[model samples]
Target: MNKEKWAIVTLSQDGVALAQRVAQQLDDKMCHIYTKEKYAKQNMQVFDTDITSFFRSIMDQYDIICGIMATGIVVRAIAPNLGHKSSDPGILVIDTKGDYVISLLSGHLGGANDAARLLAKRMDAQAVITTGTDVKGSMAVDVLAEKLNCVIADFTAAKDVTALILNNEAVALVNQENCELDGVVLPNNLELLETSRDLEEGKYAGVILTSMSRQKPEFAIPSVQLVPQKLVLGIGCRRDTPGEKIIAAVAATLAELQLNEKCIKAFATIALKQNEPGIEEACKQFKAKKVIIPDAMVQMVQSRFDGSDFVFKTTGLYAVSEPCGYIASSFGKCLLEKRKMNGITLSVWLPEK
Candidate 1:
């Protein structure tokens, strides 16, 4: 996964120094420093009138936001911007003296807890993590989904299932792929079931972790569908193609193959299409990375793929989608070789493990 951008919001001059210290320790490129116009330093951002507006403008751009101010003030400022655990940025708060690092919001999915731990070590401060899963030393399903590069199909259902795990209630993983857990420990009340029997009978509140779409009876179990990023679509669309059509075509292709849309890792394409609107739109909507494969790299792998005369004539490449997908996947196995629909051509690849 690409490293997410970071931002530091400091209310006082002392806080500004602390922010600069943090920027020096972590990635300077991804980090931003924000302050009120009155307290702004020479190289810092000065909020104009609305601090909330300034914060919101960078909310989606950054992965983690560290605020050096009073906890109550930071909370009120970010409360309105609170969103799903997966989509929201990690929120951290510390005093102007930088005495304590508090993991305030999106502790797991947005990495606030992890960021706190790191920054605490850097500053030799106490890291305050209060999540039930973390405090009790148990698995958090949302963290697991993120670590495994999966998507939660139903966020509301996930809330119910995670609540059970946190409460030490019976929960299970209806794992269809049987992928290795990599030593991931389950809570005392949770277990892994081989099939969906208990799920169908409403005997257990669990999670269904699979890339293939399954048709199951609506049962009493408060289960969530967790699908992994197992496939990447190498796509090339004609200029002016509507984003809806591009996204719909990808969806139709996945549906035809019985694959879950959530399993898509990214939209891989030639570097030439880096600014392609339809491709960019689809990727953003799906929460998939937009990977660009340079022409030289594409040329090296294009020979492995069969040439399409019409595609070469139109896109100036023998096989744009398949080669891009193959190269972007680090030469992973190709599942669906270049297939065309409307003005889009696409190929799917299983990402290298």
Candidate 2:
């Protein structure tokens, strides 16, 4: 994950000192301090523009906006730009005295709550979190996705399910494979069921874990499907293959197999092809990280895949895609078998659930 960009904004002279202190802790590079021209000091930028416009300008530029002012003032200025929690930046407010740190918006998905806690500790102030999930001691689906490094399917649905849990409504975790969560292998839900069938359809809320790309009708309940980063793609292409072809092949394969691109955490290819433009471009396009498998490891899994004799003689391995995919997945088996496209070969792997 990339480092979050933060902005420390001050409206009053008293708040300027506290803002600078927070900015100093956040570092000058990732965090910038902004203040009204009247209150601006050395090392901080002056807001020559309207205060509301200033917040509007940084809505998309910064990931977290910390305001040293009244919560109402900040809210009114930022209200117009506010959209969904999934897309908005974290909004936090602190008073001029720096006594309480308030998480004003996007408390979970955008990490305002987490940011407030850290900032409160640094400022020695109270962290005022009002999100229902925290108050009710309910499991937050978005936070779960963050911890597991997975993409959530149906963001709005996830929010609804979270609401149900926060309201003290019963929800069941259908532990199909005993999928371990952060090494807590034990079941934690009050109503644990072996399968989704155990739930009485729409009458109950449920959560299911899977690597498959979701279809809306898969679950009957107001539930969140967490697509675990279990699928990995191993790709190989002849030298000079255009990046477009490589990316298209991978995209089409995933679409056909109903696999979410977010679930594909890594892209792997033989070390020789690590610098290949096609492999590099495809991974970049999908925002997935890359893994270069050594020739020795590729050779180990080579016998498991069927390969073209010409590819074998040229690359020293019978196949690059299949072997590298397995190796990148920590030797996990392929969920989708090896496939050929033009000069490229692609295969998909999923860790054992």
Cα error, residue 217 of model 1, in Å, equals 6.1
- As a whole number from 0 to 100, the lDDT of residue 164 in candidate 2 is 66
- Predicted candidate 2 versus true structure: per-residue lDDT over 1-353, tens digit per residue: 57779998888888888887787666633888898888888878888777788899999888899999998889888988787776799999999898999999989888899899988998788999998777766667777666666667778877786776666667775654444565533224436577666777655656645345545336655666776666789888899899999888988898898767667778888877878887788887876788988888777768877867998788877788888888888788777888988988889988765
TM-scores for the candidates: 0.88, 0.76
So what's the TM-score on candidate 1?
A: 0.88
Q: Rate the local accuracy (lDDT) of all candidates.
A: 0.81, 0.78
Q: Report the C-alpha lDDT of model 1 over 31-84, residue by residue, as the tens digit.
A: 778888777777777777565776778788888999998998888888787777
Number of the predicted model whose lDDT against the real structure is largest? 1
**Of the candidates shown, which would achieve the greatest TM-score relative to the real structure?**
1
Worst 10 residues of 2 by lDDT: 182-191
